[model samples]
Target: MNASMLSYILLSCVLLSVQAHNCQVREIIRNTKSLLNKTEESWSCRETAATPCSCLPIPEPGHELACFVEGTNHMMEHNMTTDNRLFLLNQSFQIQLDRNLCESLTSGKECKYKTKGTVKTFLEKILKTYQEIHKSRV
Candidate 1:
């Protein structure tokens, strides 16, 4: 190929690589959001308030955007798709930890409590990581 043609080919390859990188970033955000939704769902599905809460996988900071978006999607599903009032309360309870603990104790036998505590800790760590990432980006 001529020099000009070779240069054009190299430029195209570079541009494509950059585009692929951007797409991967977007995918990571989407996955993070999905993880959030699953976390919410697992919280909602409780037979009783007890020890050793069900463990949900926490998404990493690298997938924060995706996880956040997924969480939002889960919220919309609960609020918009369902007529169940408990879902709303569950969402609120998930946000307020001490309150949730009280409510869980009042509602169910001793089971899955410890697991919930662990989940809370994991989430806090993930949030901190996400914050650091955002700070760096800014």
Candidate 2:
């Protein structure tokens, strides 16, 4: 499907998922911002892992992004094709073929590090996006 179509589907899932959990977008956005701040300060690229996609727990012993997902209690996991976390993960996993070569939690140090950079950049972007949205709401 085209990008617009895909986005519609993902948004649908997020809306449904939000209602199912009685979560407000405002709250999720607020929580996401808080988590992003902490992550940007400390996240790093691991040079090794016990296994691929291993759910070690936050302070998770693998890819930084995977650990972040775990902390979300899985809410950030699904219905979020639009969310940068999954999109970035999917794009990195599928598009960045070179990343598979590194000895990382699941990929390479460069890969994870690059992903961290992307996450940091996106964190800033999302923060700005939310700020704009928040301003519009007020």
* lDDT per model vs. reference: 0.38, 0.40
Q: Give candidate 2's whole-model lDDT.
A: 0.40
List the candidate 1 regions with Cα displacement exceeding 4 Å: 1-57, 80-127
Q: For model 2, where is the 10-residue window of minimal lDDT?
A: 51-60
Candidate 1, 1-138: lDDT as tens digits: 899999999998886565333323333333434444445434432334563233333444233333333333454453422423324333332332223322211232212222322333444533454344444545
RMSD per candidate (Å) reads 15.2, 13.6
What clash count does candidate 1 reach? 20
Regions of candidate 2 where Cα sits further than 4 Å from its true position: 1-25, 40-117
Compared with the true structure, model 1 gives a TM-score of: 0.26
lDDT of 2 by residue, 21-133 (tens): 32232544565566465553333323346522212232323353333334233324433224554444333323222333212333322212223323444445434544554
